[model samples]
Target: MSDPIEAAIFEKLAKADPKNVGGKSIEPADVAKELQPEQWQRMLPKVKATALGLMRQGKLTITKKGKVVDPNNFRGVIRLRLPTEAETAAALAALPPVESSDDDFD
Candidate 1:
């Protein structure tokens, strides 16, 4: 399948993570700003979808209040990041996180 959007999201996440410390995480808007400063509104949903795909693949995690969340149904603000290696493989194999129903980025 085509994955240009996913690839771009992953790249931006990687670049953003070095600054992601103390449970702070990256938001889709951050990626959008870095990759599409002038078109963030258009780019955000795609970024969320791509991030969900990554989370399902065991490459990432979606969190709210520092806890892993059901990406498909979470509400309010959330953050995305690589899943900790210490987690069981099963934890990594859960259904993928879904795109947020509301805009969650600043």
Candidate 2:
């Protein structure tokens, strides 16, 4: 598994965040961009694969293999939401206030 890509995959699966509310643990994609230059070059694909593995295990259910699945609805493109105050502000500022939607239940 010396191929950079495979190495990356291992790194991703080996180190992933685990705060998924739906019991689906966070996978490598969550930290894909965060990987160092060398790490990214090699492990990005791996992380993506790990993400898919999570989905395969039913830890997550999204269209894309390595992506954040909707917590409430798993039939669409769902990405992870940040919990930091900075992230909250960013998300809110990025979107117009949703009058009422089930997506915001979290």
**What is the per-residue lDDT of model 2 for residues 1-106, given as tens digits with 9 covering 90 to 100?**
5445335533443444343333233334545655655555475555555444444434333333655444334543334222344433543455545587567555
Q: Give per-model TM-scores.
A: 0.67, 0.31
Off by over 4 Å in 1: 18-24, 86-88, 95-106
Q: Looking at candidate 2, what is the lDDT of residue 97?
A: 53
Q: Write the per-residue lDDT of candidate 1 for residues 1-106, one digit (tens) a residue.
A: 3676666656766676665442446777787676678988898877787877677677777888889887568776778776777432656656466667786678
Q: With candidate 1 superimposed using the best TM-score fit, by how many Å does residue 14's alpha carbon deviate from the native?
A: 3.0
The TM-score of predicted model 2 comes to 0.31
| Total backbone clashes of candidate 2, pairs 3 or more residues apart or in separate chains | 2
